[model samples]
Target chain A: MPTTPAPGTVAPAVHLLAGALRRALLEEGGGFRLARVLPGREDSCAGLAAVRVLGADALAPFVVKGLALPAQDAALIRAAVRAHPAPQEPERQVLLWGIRDAALVRGLAVSGVDATGWEGLAPAGSTAHLLRLPWVAMAAELVRVAGAAPPFAEEAVHAQLARSHLDISRGLVRALLRRDLPSAACLTRWLAPAGEQLTTPALDYLEIAGADDPRVSLDTAIARRLTTGTSP
Target chain B: MTRANTPISPQGDHDDAADRSRNVETETDAAAARLAHQVGERALAWLECMRGSFALTAETPDDHVEGQALKSLAELALAAGMVRREAIAGPQCADTAGRLLDFGWRQVGRGDLLYRLQARTPAATYPMEIYAPFAAAGYRHERMDRLAAHLLGLRASRVIEHVPNRRLAVVAAAATIGVTVPDDVAAMIGQTWLGGTPEPWMLDAGNAYGVTHTVFHLTDWGGRPEGLPQRLQDYLHQWLPVWAEVFCETRLWDLLLEMLIVGTCLQRPLFFPAVWERVAAAQRADGMMPNGLTTPPADPHAAWRNHHHPTIVAVVAGTLTLSRAISHATTAGGEA
Candidate 1:
């Protein structure tokens, strides 16, 4: 029996959790249950070597769900994140890139603490985390997300603009909202090569998004690329 | 002889400098007056726009209906309050009020709009913006109480939250409607200063809103000091001059107006006079206020919406600051 949903609190991400985790969230607490279910601190760092596999999509769902963690659990996740190798600490980096829960972001911003799991990824140059990653690994993840849809035509060299990548796009928007310029710029930079493989709207948005641009769309531009195989 | 050809004596030069300084003052005065008039007109325009149909521009179309509905109603409530207070007014105030109330009633109970808007998005400062208008409109219902409770709960639960602006917004909004702020909320605000007055994050585009929202909420939309802890007040009174300078240099009209309102809230007339001057000079003749003095978007519609933000800010800040300025002047004159 999950705790009766808090009135007016309907998180789309909450549904992504299995019933057992949801039950834990209800009976125990959001923070405690999340920390219990997450990859343990050892497991967290073990995945460090597989940075390529830990893309935003694979990470967003977990991080978004982890936001409900109580302080102790939140700290546990943070501690786990800290234990990871600096270069391969993609989970915390992704969260800091603005993939974490909305409330968590608010909590971090208000508490004046770095909610971005790892402490070293400062706001000033957080993109260094993403940029430091092997370009091929990052680029491959982008292709995987963008190419999830079937090809539009036989002659098309790239995948057609198909379904959207909600998690990645939402993270991008969150990054933009937090004014995490380093992260936003890093993500936008990664998308630049895939310019020829994007949808029209995605291409337009990419042209418009910058570290300093005030307005940003919640839509994931890169994920919806309508590349006709020609460079944008 | 042409004035340029005239050789000036020391006495003449001194007198000339004095005349030039006096002329500058006159020009500044003229500009302020012009801006005040334009702001008044533009405020009325914002109200009129709301009186018909209004959409929440800030939210994505794909956001949940509750988010949209809550944001829309909150904006409406604020607009209605603005109209009622004559912060933005027209003969259409009555009509706008009717439409707003009707719209509000239609979507009142559809979801947990209140909690979803407030607690779910704690960093957002717009929810704080909603408080003054909703309270000013004298809106009281079970939902409002629920919102008030949710805000209080968030404060109690999160020992220290991100976005000082959002914390201030919740505390200040609760204060506006006569809700007693929990000790924790007050303590939470005090915690912000514990880090030795967090330097204004002005370079971050979002902080422009965050900093101003902090000022507005801390001061309770320029209403009273009950919501503000004394230490925070002193901290703001000391640092506002520097913050206002930074905001002015950025030439962000929305922020400049927000800084003006902060000055009004603190009752510190001297804090942002230079910013006030620049804002007045930047006003267009037709009463539009652009987002900033930076390069605008290439698209015309995008450009117009950008203009809309500052124009609305100008209305709220202008109305509050100008009216307060007048009242202060009148009171000072009376005391003299």
Candidate 2:
């Protein structure tokens, strides 16, 4: 016959403990659980232990599983989980909502939604840091969707290339879409005459410019052109 | 007829003297014009050659990368010749000299061309003939000389201080060329020699020597007086030996060309004997010198040896012939 802790105190404490553990598990490098519980009444200890165990293993697999969920529902859970850590703060919740809206407009599944949202949530001046995200897949997906849609044009491609750290020129973007080598080589050659213009910002972008197949000679030629300048 | 029979009067003698003076002045003016014309022609030719080489290098693909090397060597030779000719003949042809001077000054001011020349030629191989024109044009040769010395001295000091192991070859070469090391350069070298602590990279003797040799040639050639036989003598006696050792060890074709330039510029007694020995040792059965030194084997396959060997041998032979002529002239009562 174990004495139960007062219902109000026990419920609030358990909720608060659960909340903290959830935040730690979600935010810390891929969630871990507390192995042992602190000494307490059997019921309270059992609740704490259960929450810790469930929170650690449950959160990761649940989020990973949610990746295949319908885009709308997945977005809702991602927003809920992100906002869960600090529900009292309306601004953070609003920020997470804005990112969810952007992801929805782009038609991307917000699988790593919290990480993605957190990346964009820094204050206005921290945009540079936000831009460092490995958004290649998202950008590629966006480009594909944009191609199918009539509104996406060369202007959109140019803007993306300009803003993104992806090493791609306007011509390279077109080449990527077309999967043509001669056109890519023509652009590369035009940019880097005898490898002189290889290091130009346009060319540097072309070097790490992700494509299904990266042209080594063209990239090298571009790099060389940039370094030495009009190689003669 | 009766007046001439009385022996030309004092007025007639005065007229003749006046006519002679006018003729002399006209000849001088014509000579000046001719010299100027010659300078302009040569300068243009050199510029054209440089442009051609640059174009040739640019057109070459990766597999033909060796074309660039040949172009580089040609450009260096052209630049050296242009500078030397302009400096020597510039005063005699002020207009042409002025143009050439402006060009050289501009190039030197940019710093890149000077660095490139230094990279190619040994420090002691600068053409003394160039300084003569500036001196003739009423420019202060000593001040220019001192400025060059200071610039080279500072560069040497930096290399010695920041990079110590390379100091030996550089310092030894500088000493050989009789390059007056400022107090700072000397101190830095001395400190390094006396077991002063060096950076991690400075511990490798080969790298140190190689880097120092580069700096030495650069500062040395870039630092010499425009025109002075004693300076040339210093280069031949002091600098050439260390370079020879480096040359023998490395057998870099460029180094051989540098040796040739030094031989042509100095024509010192000490140089020809050593150079001839190097030449004799370098000559292959097919009359080709190995493109680069083979000992110490930087690569196992002797991959570095290539077409440049024949070119270097030809350059050395030409330089030797030039040196012989200079030696004869100097010995035949021309200023040593």
Using TM-score as the measure, the top candidate is 1
Evaluate model 1: give its lDDT: 0.44
CA deviation > 4 Å runs, candidate 1: A1-232, B1-34, B50-53, B56-63, B66-76, B86-132, B143-160, B193-195, B198-208, B225-239, B270-287, B293-305
* lDDT, residue A65, candidate 1: 34
Per-residue error for B193 in candidate 1, Å, reads 6.1
Instruction: Indicate the worst ten consecutive residues by lDDT in candidate 2 chain A.
Output: A144-153
lDDT of each: 0.44, 0.35
Residues B249-309 of candidate 2 have per-residue lDDT tens digits of: 4556445544544443443322333344555455443333355544323331242234333
Model 2 residue B157 CA deviation in Å: 10
Candidate 1's TM-score reads: 0.44
Q: What is model 2's native contact fraction? A: 0.00
Model 1 residue B90 lDDT score: 44
